[model samples]
Target: MFPKTHLTIAAGATVLVAATVLMSPSSNVEAKRMSYALDLEQGSVSAPAKGPASADEQNSGEVKTDTASSSAPTSGEKGQTEATVAAAPSEPALDWQAFEIKSGDTLSSLFKAAGFNDGIMLSVIHGEGDADKLQRLYAGETIRFASDDQGKLAAVELQRNRLKSLKVSRTDDGFKGQILTREPEARPMFASGVIDDSLYASARAAGLNDKLTMELTDIFGWDVDFVYDVRKGDRFEVVYQDLYLDGKKLGTGKILSARFINRGDERLALLYTDDAGNSDYFTPDGKSMRKAILRTPIDARVSSPFNLQRRHPVLGVVRPHEGTDYAAAPGTPIKAAGSGRVISAGRKGGYGRAVVLQHGDGITTLYAHMSRIARGMKAGSRVKQGQTIGYVGSSGLATGPHLHYEYRVNGRPVNSRTVKLPDAKPVPSSEMAQFRKVADQRLAQFNVFEGREQQLAMAEEE
Candidate 1:
């Protein structure tokens, strides 16, 4: 390479290294896995970047102009739908067969039955973090595994955005496996709902989730709250992407549009376009959700501790507390730290009137010292994050009213608030351009979706 070219390469490596250092932990879950090995001493880029197969391939938007086309949003469209383009007319005889799982079928067994030998099955499973990571595939969720023009495994795509739509292919596999990744389409849409009873109830009624409900609150939590802020007749709506692969569903992507009505006031939000045309959720007037830091650390101050034994203030005896306590007042509503459901909503020993939530992954929490439970609160009810289930009252063995909180990993008491949460994220820089491209298209379509809704409402004389 020429000396000028070498300088250009060296400069490029520096920016990537800087990005690794400055990358936000919340922006991408995969950031931790990125380790920059730049040789600053010589100002030389790494061998990986030097090779023909490099991480910059897709990030640079150097997608192959092959027959395998991706569904993208066209600019200026007000509304859009899930547009899928499968193998067109019968030309190459691409045997794209869809398989529904049988009771006795495993990935390995099925691949063998398909005449490809199960050699790729083991690797595929591990790469997917097992079948559960493969869109939580239980007994029934189907995957449309396919091959390309080269007859090599084109991709193993899930039918929905329940989990990520994963694909693996190779440019070359010499000493190392040369892989190329094609991101599935993640399109934006507009969704809205009203809560006559509770957040989770409303979300489920609107075809959403306790998880998505929590996410919406989190996005706007710096302003509106899930507890006292939620009025009896509050309402909400949102625009987020539904990720897909080869027309198959992968899962919901980031939110693009949102509306939360507390009392009678409506708060409308839209995804704004940046200088680079990258889209991020913003208020209708345009304000970024990227805060300097989270409002609270893991949990509220003095909310919880990790001690097993404590000197009982009233009992005057050293006993196992088994949970940390948050100091608050009676009727101080408690909210879920994340999206989850109520497993228990009544009293417990010494803890007084308590509420317990069973978040997924064997994680659970206990909220105590309640003066009274929220109206319509009960076991088996879903709760969005920060949604109020009860108030703080001196009901249990307490000097005053406060919330006793506990976080459990597996079956052990891990501080729920302080749990160093695992991270996943936005598209990598290597994947950013294409990611933004699709996101832009989705944003445009979302406007149209909302417009049609307004038109329909008008037609009904609402």
Candidate 2:
């Protein structure tokens, strides 16, 4: 009986131990799991297991806790969680294709090469006003295309130049075009040169381009004859505008002011525009730089001077030479001395091909010995100053290719070299003050540039 009781007690104790192990807090194994919900719009992460209190619940001054449970969430909770996830918006991806225009390449061909059809090209071009720019494409330009994920063109951009572009973008209604322009920064620059052999050579040595050099000559051509008056030591100084884009020099703009020293004579010119929007070069004292007629009709050396009694080279007899002869290469262009009406344009007895111009104030000019007259130059046709009238040739009574130019006043021949040219109208008294103000500023700049050049020369010599 004692053995039976001990056995029973041991069994009872073992059962109690097994019950304690299953019911104790430490013995209860809780599996720790986490769930994440991404808020894509806000770019944040939310924990579903221990989410913050709801806004409505908090406003009522009550807190709702998510009680721990081993089962799945309720149907209402599941629906709310799914609604939060579906609120994010999706954006489509864009693909870009770029093409460089080549010689003989058309918009149609470029579009086809990029895997686009003619219909797409036509729709984009015919939709709006900007489509016209696509038709004016030139070689060496670039066009970029942007398309959505569905392969529909979203935008097109044409880079016209460094400072201009044309853009076309698709809208709900259609495509719209816009022209974009960027302003270039202007910087003041100075250039000075001393003539050693020729004006062009000296200008090039002074870092002047052909365009700027020509402008310089034109500005001072009224006061000095470039062919006859330019001496070996003549000097020039100029202040001009240098255009730049993105810190790189593109080209030159305009000559603000300049000075020319020829044969010990100094001449200054300033550019000014009046309230009437007329721009012209003027002297420091407000006098106009342009005259009624240019000094020479053609850029040629004088081969024969005006002589009363000279032995004619062609006829070999003493004859009165009434006009100055300009020696030039055959086919060289001859320009009209001033604006006038063509009185005659045809072949004469001794002057092979001749053109006569009748100007204002009873002044007339004639050009003879030409290879051919300029087309459209006929009797009664109006001609502007500096217009080409004919070409140089050894026609009629001539020894070589030359232009026999004669300037007459009231039917009497006059020496073109020594004749007093009529000056253009000066600045009116009402605008003199304004003109002087602008002129003073430009002249100051010109002086500054000249002084700097002088200092540089002195430094170089030292």
Candidate 3:
């Protein structure tokens, strides 16, 4: 059944094909030629194949051939190939250098020190977005640069702080800028203190910083006089926030809630944010922590008290001293007693450089013997409570540098130290339920801290 002639011809053709392939260049040589073609298309230099390649070269050639065959365009791949050709080339590996900002380091000087030209600096500063951050660089900040083999700026990064950075990268059009931010983790912290000598000392003993101590004073300032009302047994507890980044503590955050017991009177304050995004400290019963007026306009020693009949120091006559005098440094700032509009700001006969503010409910406050009234504090100018109105000085007929402060109701002088200030508006009824929930949680945390402290104290006593 075999056809010898046809079978012999088929075998001869296979031998002829094998001979042609063997006479041709090796697989490596063919791969080199194809690779050269690809390099030419990509505008890259290629070396000519010189001699017979090793087994590794042959294997690599097979891979390259397979890759080329796979990458050959089909009906659907034609558009993709064109798009790839039009796209920009991949950037070369960059050489990065970090520079610490120095006292006299200007942007120009920094660029020059980094081996970059003025053109690159200008282009980066005038980049697409957030380029203004470059102008606000501080002396302690750090800036990093990346350049290509050709010494062209590829990217630049300015570290503003631990959690913020500004980055500028070169694009086909120009440089593009972006601000990068890292959110910190908020960890709840609890601290409690019992006053032994002062609020600051006790707070420090309880591992609280000066900033937190100041905040504690401000939270209870409406009801407690830190200078006078603080007793040996007064205690305080606070639940606050501690910020952490990458497992390292950054600093303290807002005071979530606080409790202060002064002279056996307990006061609780909770931080609450309403639907309108306004935040303030409030009592568990929804009353605001702030008052309409502060108890003292300035932190100082009271030099003179309000007396119905007294002999004036300068006039040497029997005059009714209607105001309290606070002895302070010459340039100590005097704050407004309440939120009001200035009624008068001028020199009086005995009260020089006086500024009077008139508040609601027939209340008026006067600050006199000022070295200089605050700029823009003219008649009809609105001011907030605790805003600086003037500085302390012996500007009037006074014997020393002090502030003469007066509180009046219905045109009658009253003792500023003994007068009671009205409380601020309470939380709105619509948000009272939500406020109570937050207050309860914060109070519970504060109580837990207090309980722990009490247990520790009892153990020590035992």
Candidate 4:
């Protein structure tokens, strides 16, 4: 209803106002630009977005401080060279998480301390999954506690057995745990030592312990009695396998080579296992170290017997004793002189805590003054040849701590000090040929295991 002149003039006024506003720079207007920089890949540090933020007002509050980033150019500055930012490298998840178990720490309490919720720890510890492992929640053992970004615990690993690491990523029904298995690893190593003193002492000086010592003894046990067989200046060299997992050593896997020299007699053995899983030690000449029986039957520490006619500490008697006695430190182990049965294990006059073993062919051996008898050691219990019967002590008419040991032939005491025991049982006349062949094969393996110098010197010593 308005005149044409009024409508036309109103439109012209709106257009002119829009033009002015577009030309003006408003204070609220923002132009955003992105920035980036190079940085070394040190894991454990979180990285932020590298792209530019949009100039939109809605997204302004979403930005965090970008670490490892360079600042952008300022306004009104001429463009300079822009260094292309390297892409941030990726990092794998952590292997273990450290956790300490305080007193009264049950599985439930530990799960809470490790930032876990209800039911997860109990399920895993109690084997709700297919792990089929025994549950362990000891107070001192550490465990590794791990979780995913969503905060679910995946697996649990004992951290040095004091702390637990739980990985909640792979559990059944969505609970995860540590990787369960690994491939087997085998490695070879060599050790050599000269016996300046005792074989065990020298081996220990060369960094061997109970486990390794047992390994060494087992390698040569078939050939050497170890107790009464080693001579001074005896040298031993062995090459064995070291078993490992994740680069950590577990134990000695096997003994490949071993050499022993007793009284200037040379004996070298190698370990050999046939296709049928039969293994033994044998000399290079194809002789089995395993005779029908071991030559020396005692496990005594000393080679010489006690001299009773000298100074007497308690009895004060200058009587020349008829028997040789062994002095073991109060409770040292005492073994049988041979495969025998208990003739008597009870007290006999001054032979306090004594045990008498009777072997076949009218031979009897006696041990006296024991600290205590091995449990269940009675007259009827069958004992193996080298099994411990009692500890050593001063019992009968003795001066100090020692075992009064006597050897008897046909019920009469004899000088065990001078008696030469019988030789090894010859291999069954029928099994002799096969035994020699088996022995030779083992000896060949031993040579391959020990290097050249060891073989030569061992040969000379033998």
Highest TM-score: give the candidate number: 3
> Compared with the true structure, what per-residue lDDT tens digits does model 4 show for residues 1-462?
999999999998888778645644443332233343323222344445644445653455333335532233344331332322233334324444666666777666666778776677666755544332424555666766666556666567654331223333454575434534444477866666777778889888866666767877765665565766677788777666787776787766666666666666666666655445667655554455553322333445442354546444456667555466665578888777677678889777877888888777687888887877777577866776678888877766556677777877788776765555543343454655766676565455555655565687799999
Choose the strongest candidate by lDDT.
3
Cα deviation of 391, candidate 4, in Å: 2.8
> Candidates ranked by TM-score, best first?
3, 2, 4, 1
Report every candidate's CA lDDT. Answer: 0.61, 0.85, 0.86, 0.62
In the order shown, the candidates' Cα RMSDs to the true structure are 23.3, 14.3, 11.1, 14.8
Model 3 lDDT tens row, 1-462:
569998999999899778656655666456455323224223566655655657886666643345554433565787887787656344456788999998988998888889998888999899899865776778899998988778889888999899999989899989888999999999888888789999899999988898888998899988888988899999988888999999999999889998899989999899999999998999889999998988889989889989979899999999999999999999999999899999999898789889999998999999999999999899999999889999999997999999999999999999988888888889999988888888888878887877887899899999
lDDT of 3: 0.86
TM-score (C-alpha, index-matched) for candidate 3? 0.78
Which stretches of model 1 miss by more than 4 angstroms? 1-176, 264-266, 272-280, 284-286, 290-293, 296-448
Using lDDT, rank the candidates from best to worst: 3, 2, 4, 1
Give one digit per residue, the lDDT tens place, for model 1 in 1-462: 579989999999898777645542332333324333554323555434233434675366343434432323244331333222222322233345467766766766666655556556655554533233542454665656666567656446554434434433222441112223558797765666778778778888877766677778776665565654677788887777777877888677677667788888776555555556675555433345533222231234564365667778779988767776777756666766555778888888887887877776676777777888887668888876567777778887888877777666677876543455432223345645654575566556766887887898899995
Worst-scoring 10-residue span by lDDT in model 2? 24-33
Q: In candidate 3, which residue ranges exceed 4 Å CA deviation? A: 1-93, 458-462
Model 2 whole-model lDDT (C-alpha atoms): 0.85
Query: Could you tell me every candidate's TM-score relative to the true structure?
Result: 0.37, 0.70, 0.78, 0.55
